[model samples]
Target chain A: MATIQHPYLLFLGDAPDQLAAKTANGVKVWRPEWCIGQFRLPGCKADLGLPDVSIEEAAAQGAKTVILGVANRGGFIPESWIVELVKALGLGMDIASGLHTKITAIPSLKDAAERNGRKLFDVRHPSRDYPVASGKPRPGKRLLTVGTDVSVGKMFTTLAIEKEMRARGLNADFRATGQTGIFIAGEGASIDAVIADFISGCVETLAPANSEDHWDLIEGQGSLYNVSYSGVTLGLIHGAQADALVMCHEIGRPHMRGLPDYPVPEIPTAMDTILHMAKMVNEDVKFVGVSLNTSNVSADEAAAFKAKTAEQTGLPVVDPLKDGVAPIVDRLLAG
Target chain B: MATIQHPYLLFLGDAPDQLAAKTANGVKVWRPEWCIGQFRLPGCKADLGLPDVSIEEAAAQGAKTVILGVANRGGFIPESWIVELVKALGLGMDIASGLHTKITAIPSLKDAAERNGRKLFDVRHPSRDYPVASGKPRPGKRLLTVGTDVSVGKMFTTLAIEKEMRARGLNADFRATGQTGIFIAGEGASIDAVIADFISGCVETLAPANSEDHWDLIEGQGSLYNVSYSGVTLGLIHGAQADALVMCHEIGRPHMRGLPDYPVPEIPTAMDTILHMAKMVNEDVKFVGVSLNTSNVSADEAAAFKAKTAEQTGLPVVDPLKDGVAPIVDRLLAG
Candidate 1:
């Protein structure tokens, strides 16, 4: 995957304030040069501290592309955002959105992009039909970071693992499965947005079959314990047919995000379930390690969390950001 | 679900001889009038004695419906079945198929059925758009038999449970999710055949809102441990919003039915995974009992297996067919 060389404007359209992290994540990771003034629903807190500028203002600042950075439920771009989008297109910025509801599906947006002779990137639409999983062994070694819950650092862990692997002189690539990863990498399918039946097939297409010395670090989605999206997770697991797995977890979460009644599952139980499920399709699948997310904890707390999780699961555990993913990378290489 | 009063001819259609059990299952359970001759692939055994006849002969025997009864890999109906299908339609018989490839998709077969004014029953097509799962409390209680692997008596156990419940004077209905159960019950969506995204939605529609005393005994599908089909299993669990569960395990099965390397997961782990996953969606879900499939085991072995499984899981275990589902029914009622 190559980086996008064109300067782009990040657009967070009428998103609820609670989604600031998601919006900020795109900016921080993708490092878009200029961001349009924040757009938010009423009562949303806008505290990210980026310079507030309108779409025209950002375009004047040399933004050649507009990337929708905030997530909306059902991925529907708001009606209000269309006007600003048109103005941006009129200002000569190409539009790229990862929403399930494609920007191309909106006639006005489609026409504006076409009239301007600019590309409209819809990352969710799969380019072609993918073959159903044959349960055959692929040529390359694949590593997937599955999580105990959504937003528990699967993507971050995957990226970190890939970085460490490459540093150690291994051929490694990060296979993106979500919007943030796609924005940073400049190519990938939003597996969740793909039609459910074809998700596994799409994942299969994402990670090209390669030789054994090559490593594909695949990002994951919803947990097996997450009912609303377990299908996506299962599909990714079976589709990638990974040789090794890294379980991801966040510290101090009492329940699944947005699911108050459902407590976060025990890490060991989650790990075992993933290992058994993966091995069911790929007989040689193994649980190589764990990746801990200690974003909100102190250094001492993070260390204790890592040690405890490692002891409990009997797998090396590390915070990718704090401790680096070298231990997990070593485990993957050994396997 | 109501009974199909029409006399249907079971079409085994060039399937290998080992699939006789699948054909015989439909006949024994659905009990269509006067058995028709078996069809076989060349060099295949035809030891299941029934009237050996062609499709035309079956139509002559007053068969008004042609039910494609044998299971095929990849759910593709063999090309050789087209000729017999054309002949059957010419005889004014309606065609019904449970295979993933809809019979209606075959232009010739569809034209024949339509021209003859006969209905084409594509049993796997979802009857209607089912609503996304709201995770709200459903009206009636539901009992779903989950399994450690596919073909482990989920449907039979569900039927047995409903039977025992009804005999004890409780309101009960069997919710079928596969072909054989659908044939017996006269109405059901094949949950496995539905597109992955809407599987949970279809299951939600199968067992509708009802009064408090009502009980919907939902038949299960592929196991959560079965990698090839875990999405279907997970979707069904969440969609059913079941209040109680029966863990089903087959005695003497060393591995998953089709995937050889995928060993049948240990019953306790499978039970816990199902419980945890279900509880994540439906907080009230409970593991009520165990259903053991002892068809291939000796009487003594079956008894010992039942006892050991019951002791291991700390739940009452019974062979629903031989010993009756009374114990499981009692637990469901108590819950």
Candidate 2:
């Protein structure tokens, strides 16, 4: 790699929240900012205020480079985003799996990114679809799922949290298969059918996503689709599609009580909650990551929560801004 | 494994279209009739129509589940709709990811869903502040940001497209992260920021979803979220986001001969368009998976385009929906 220079790195993405944390030589830096975007399905009457962004815009911001972060959940951010990322960011965009949109966008984006001084990075280590090549699924292995809640910034903080652990060195990964909750269909699809469908759907996704030493980091944002910025995907209810199980709390309320007394919820503590969920998803939770939302909690509180989590979970907690993420990535990578 | 009755499986969501074939055995269905309620983002001028329900609803509805479907886009959808889903659909009610409305509603929702034999499926993933275990970053091996636009059904149909391949044994887990489109968010953070903020301020929304899977057979009457349907989410954008992506022919008068009808610019043959983008992104384009809008092109045309791609790149040209998503995921997972 021609000895890449410039220690400080900021991953600008349409999903700024997902790209939180400033990094330098494997250490954390200034407040990590995550990009949060809200969108609505065309022709639909609702507006889902979620966290996401285009790879192009992410790169366009002119950072050393930008990372295309995907939800560990089996889905995509539109082929257009990937295509844009290739021409915008360097170090490339990382795809969770080459299933739906990524399959189409990444490849196209690979070529685009190459020309733009960037490239596409595949994050799906052992795809479930490639059975012969994939190793068996093992809990507490390399990959894991760290569930999260609403609040784009929190999600970003959580998603970008690998730096701290990496700074120390650990074997872990988060399975971010977008929020997993109840899904519904107007038709008469039964619950068992729904559960089975949910299971199978997720299996189909994470199965191909199967990998060794890999863990999951799922998010259970309150109130899935149809509701404001809270709810699960429609796919969850139809097929058995939850491989990265997540547990979240509803924070998308207005003037809610017990909060830090701000528009945003208390993030640091919220992260502590997800750490517990990480254990439930995988008992031996090797390492932990958190997603903080400044809008919700104070930076100090977020930092304090980090220490508390380390004390409670007995697992190293990472804050992308304070700790570089490369070290954490190394720990998660197979030797 | 104790012959696990339900397996309590988890799906890595992806495309709903391709999942139709994949979900036959284990289905993941979304209410094709649902809609998000978004007027405009707190900063941006776009909308996001997300889903609203819980994991409990999926279990009850009997959706086998597949990859990320649309509906989850959080932009607009009356908050009351969520109440209806919780009250009527039971497991059908879910929450979007952005904003604070739903996150704050969790405590009360537990009662509503539990009383109806459903679970809220909370959101609690790791944050950027997650403490490190083994003193390492433990960055997950991958990241995915999945979503869609054009409404819930289109998002569902477009996102679920991995099915045709899954039936062939491709594991394309879908995860719906709602929607995040360019045309949706303007370049300026001022307006965009406001829209984004307003979106964050939102929560506890309602979007009644309806899926378009093979079993559900939602053919003629499309979703209430589609342009065909009388949805305001699309109107909110004033044809900016979607229109920007559109290509047209310089035919005549105030509007020329439109496009879709005469097929002048012809939406640029998939191969030609991809190749153009490929050159812009990278030069060494090899494998590619094309999911053509069958609704727009004919079998012969699609075949011809695929043939052209193969001839031009000398790499594998796979049809995402038909070929399944396994090969693509396999390549990304290569050691």
Candidate 3:
């Protein structure tokens, strides 16, 4: 992950609220000063309070890359946005998009970027050379944080565990597999964005060969119980080939995110599902600990739920943000 | 699924004995003469008793479509096979490949096919327009047979259920997803071949709006517990929007297919996982029955295992072939 040449412009599409909450691609704003300003659709609310500028203004402000930072349902980039995207490309701005719709695949936008001698980075476009999972045990200690459902803090858990491990002077690195994780880590493939067949291969390349003493904190994606996104979840699990996993869950997500009818599986059931999934590729895989996301709950409620989860799972449980992922990191180190 | 115009030539690249097992793609031999024998590498035994012929010779024998029938690990087509494939295409024979490596994507192969006016039917190529799962309850009663792992009789169970249902005057069709199922039914896409994100969409296209009384028996691929292939499983589960599920397992199997290190999950746990996974998309989804593959066990063992599974799962159990899937079909029909 080389330093992305700076002076970026964030494209906030039709919905500015999504980016305001740090959902989807909003995490890129963590380094806000580098962003010249945001470009939103005409009449679209700029709820995030960033200066809304036109494509010409953004370019004048030294925006070198236009980052499409608001994700819509199905990841379909609006057709109207292509006109603005072309304008940005014509203005000598490279396009960086994590959407399922590849900007490079759009003929008009592609021609504009090519004429401008600018590049298009379709982050979801997978590498062609990812090798299939060999099922043989690989060297190095790896730990993946699987969640009960999406937005259950899998990335946070992995980062927290990696942070704790680094604090102890152990060799560990957080492997990002989504937009936010990639933005945070500066280098990582979006696992869910990789083509289904090559997801494991993409994952394999994310954390290349490491020494047996090195611990790669591979981030997990969608839950096994998430029917819509479980394919990515399974691919990540098999691809990571982790020696052990830390299960992550929000304290009271009764149903899948945005899918109220789909009830979240109990912590034990979720653990069993993930373990069963992991054991398919790595027989030695075990549950190292649990990371509970108690953001919506009180501190006392979080602690009570954490204790209950630990007792049920017979694993150390911690809220990665509140109490730190020390218990899980310690377990991994001890093991 | 349209009629495949095929006077077929089976391509068994490296290992000939694998196709002899009548597993995976070997069941394409269900229609023997459509196959103008098999084409194998020199010195590789064609143990299935099909005459070994060269691609040129097979083309002369009126083979219209060359079916890459034997699945290799990772579906990697040998580079040398491409030379033979191009020669086959040069002779005006359409190539029907189920491999993960798309023949149509190969530049040489594509050019040859285009020049020769021969079509490349990559059965695994998913339709680009698969809609994301809306999570709405769809009309009609659909049943998907989920297996403990790959090769655990999901297709066999599905076909048997369809047979029983049809025999009982119910309108049930076996929706095929694998090469064998396609060969048997004369139509179906290999769901595993589809890009991971579009698996559900492919499944949706496989069985469109059916009458309320109709039952579509979707042939399942891979297991929810099999980490390497669970993406396809979850995709099929959600895409089918099944009302009831039939759990399938092989008796006395100790490990995941191909992966020797990973042990097979117990039937109850496997059932729990499938049910939990299905419930995430279709809240009304239920396990109507369990179908065990008792090919390895004696009749007595099979019967005892069926009885034990019934007791363990509290569902009707049967070996779809030997015992007939009538018990399970009856349960589904009853429901």
Number of the top-ranking candidate, with DockQ as the measure: 3
TM-score of 2: 0.25
Interface RMSD values for all candidates? 3.1, 19.0, 2.4
lDDT of 1 by residue, B52-124 (tens): 5677787887777777766665666666778788888898777777676788788988888888877777776
How well is each residue in A140-191 modelled by candidate 1, as lDDT tens digits? 8888889998999998888878768877888998888887787666677777
Estimate, for each residue in A58-152, the C-alpha lDDT of model 3 and write its tens digit.
Answer: 98888887776566656667787898989888888887776767777888888888898887876665534455554556788788888888888
Error of 1 at A112 (Å): 13
Candidate 1 recovers a fraction of native contacts equal to: 0.23
Best by TM-score: 3
Top lDDT hit? 3
Of the two candidates 1 and 3, the one with more favorable TM-score, higher being better, is 3
Separate DockQ for every predicted complex: 0.22, 0.02, 0.36
Q: For all the candidates, what are their Cα RMSDs to the real structure? A: 7.0, 26.9, 6.1
Candidate 3 pairs with clashing backbones: none
Q: Which of the predicted structures, 1 or 3, would earn the higher DockQ when compared with the native? A: 3
Q: Of 1 and 2, which scores higher on DockQ? A: 1
How well does candidate 1 match the true structure, expressed as C-alpha RMSD? Answer: 7.0
